[model samples]
Target: MRRKRAAGEPQWFFRRLVAIGVIGFAAWRLMMLESAPDTRVNETIAWGWILLMATVVLGYLGFASAQDIVAIFATRSGTPYAALDDPTDPPERPSEPPRNFAG
Candidate 1:
């Protein structure tokens, strides 16, 4: 028999499903280039950019959606917990100055 998993742990099944869907969509977008119509250089360049931007937008949206779904699953699986670290403590500072300093 399988052991019960704790809440807030990543659900592998859902994560895998989302991963497959994202990869499949990305592959489909790549395959679309093979069927692009014959056209002038300028138009072809524009079409290429359009396809590229579409893929980027699709990827961003897919990632955001998947994250939201995972968050939902995690929250629903169990009660939320308090932070383990002491909140009153100040955040640690880096040992050296940042590279962008112009002073």
Candidate 2:
């Protein structure tokens, strides 16, 4: 009953898994640093780590949103994969003459 996945599906899933693991690890490290009184982690280093993790998370979100925007525009305009069908051939032009709007 399940549908077949595309060629890159497994790799995509693996990448997502790795990303989640990294983010989770970062969160766990932050929590540990905050809770442990014995550990002498520098405040500046902690702030830097927080900034780095925030950048990674924000960059991922931004990239995903940008991809979604592109997909939406592609669907609205025309088939996004039209070029993939036949890369060598140029796109077909409409037979009708161009319309004027100067009037």
Candidate 3:
């Protein structure tokens, strides 16, 4: 038997983890600055952080959706429904032998 490799072994996994960490840190910094009475937060920096985070999230989602759509179409030559009702194919049967049931 062959071993099946994990999907997105390390690249995508690490990228997502790093993105989440950066987003969390940015949010925490923003909140801390807001709560401090004397600290004046830079508006441009905060907005830039938010915009960058949104772009990363949206890009990841779009790429993932495109991969899924392409996989579905690439795997099949015709509609799934048509495959089930094709007349030339033999009906599938179980490989197990019949059991004696008289007890």
Candidate 1 on 1-103: residue-level lDDT in tens? 9765644444567656765676666567656655777568646765665676567668766976776577667666333332234578788987896679688
| Candidate topping lDDT | 3
lDDT of each: 0.62, 0.64, 0.65
Per-candidate total of colliding backbone pairs: 0, 0, 0
Candidate 1 residue spans exceeding 4 A from truth: 1-39, 77-103
Q: Write the per-residue lDDT of candidate 2 for residues 1-103, one digit (tens) a residue.
A: 9565532222246556766777787777777678556444556656766887787778767876676568658567344323333377788987998888896
What TM-score would candidate 1 get against the native?
0.34
Measured over all alpha carbons after superposition, the RMSD of each candidate to the real structure, in angstroms, is 20.2, 13.5, 10.9
lDDT of 3 by residue, 5-102 (tens): 43432246676887788778878876766655652346666677788778878877787677656655865633322223347868788789888899
Model 1: number of backbone collisions: 0
Q: RMSD (Cα, Å) of candidate 3?
A: 10.9
Off by over 4 Å in 2: 1-12, 35-41, 77-103
Best-to-worst lDDT order: 3, 2, 1
Candidate 1 — worst ten consecutive residues by lDDT sum?
77-86
Return the clash pairs for model 2, or none: none
* TM-scores of all predicted structures: 0.34, 0.47, 0.48
